[model samples]
Target: MNLDQYLPVLLFIIVGMAVGIGPLVLGYVLGPNRPDDAKNSPYECGFEAFDDARGKFDVRYYLVAILFILFDLEIAFLLPWAVALQDVGLAGFIAVLIFLAVLVVGFVYEWKKGALDWE
Candidate 1:
């Protein structure tokens, strides 16, 4: 295999890394070293923390967040499938329909399990 084919990819990766790391290097070098009590203290919207930062939270919060992300990502697949609907033809359409049906079933299951209920 010709190594020349990979030169552009190598250069692309090097440039990408430099672009990402350059600003961070410059900021550390040029930024002032300043640390005050106000800056170091734990703050919450201009007020001091009233409770422990490691306080336990309700499991429902996490469950709801995960469900939202799961459904959100599943929905995102629709966009690409929609854009290429013409090229994908009947088989692709049926596949997306099956995917949607499964998504609906999962949603109904979650709903029946009281996961969607908020007290």
Candidate 2:
């Protein structure tokens, strides 16, 4: 291994650090220092913190969050599938269909169990 091969990697690390830290330093120096009650208060899931931070949360809150993540990840698969559609051909299409079918079944199960109900 030659040092020449590592030069780009070193430059990339330096650039990444600059990109990450530059805006943060600039914001601290240039942004307004306006803090109020709302800004200082602890917020949880868009609601004001009412109970002990470590206390149990409603199971539905976690269920809804998990459902959102599940669908979000499913949609993420579409990007790669779309890119490789021609390469994968019909088998990929069928595999995605099967994946969607399983998701729909889980969705129906959750719906029947009232996991989606707000109350």
Candidate 3:
């Protein structure tokens, strides 16, 4: 097996590691060591932490976050499909319609369940 083909992969790994760790290394070496009460304190939403670190959070918080990611990714998929509309033709169009139908059904289900309600 020719080892030359692996040279680029090795270099890529080295560069990737350097890029990932370089900032931390430089910051630790060059940055000042400073810690104060305000800087080290737990902060939340422009205020100090009011609850315990492991306090229970409302289930709706997680539900909303998951729904946001679900809808966000589904929307992101539309960009590629739109770009390839000419190549995919009618079949792709119908597939996307079905996908959209499913998405709408899920949204409606969540809405009916009051998952979207903040209060």
Q: Write the per-residue lDDT of candidate 3 for residues 1-119, one digit (tens) a residue.
A: 99999999999999999999999999999999887787767564333555477866778778988999999999799999999999999999999999999999999999999999987
Candidate 1, residue 73: Cα displacement in angstroms equals 0.5
lDDT of 1 by residue, 1-119 (tens): 99999999999999999999999999999999898776767663444544577876678878988998998998699999999999999999999999999999999999999999987
The TM-score leader among the candidates is 3
Q: What local lDDT score does residue 70 receive in model 1, on the 0 to 100 scale?
A: 92
lDDT over C-alpha atoms for residue 65 of model 1: 89
Residue-wise lDDT of candidate 2 within 5-110, one digit each (tens)? 9999999999999999999999999999997887867676655665467877778788889999998999998889999999999999999999999999999999
Report how far residue 43 has shifted in candidate 3, in Å.
6.5
Among all candidates shown, the one with the greatest lDDT = 3
> Candidate 3, clashing residue pairs?
none
- Displacement of the residue 59 alpha carbon in candidate 2, Å: 1.2
By TM-score, rank the candidates, best first.
3, 2, 1
Task: Please list the Cα RMSD from the true structure of every candidate, rounded to 1 decimal place.
Answer: 6.0, 4.4, 4.1
Q: Which pairs of residues collide in candidate 1?
A: none
What lDDT does model 1 reach?
0.89
Q: After superposition, which runs of candidate 2 have C-alpha atoms over 4 Å from their true positions? A: 1-48
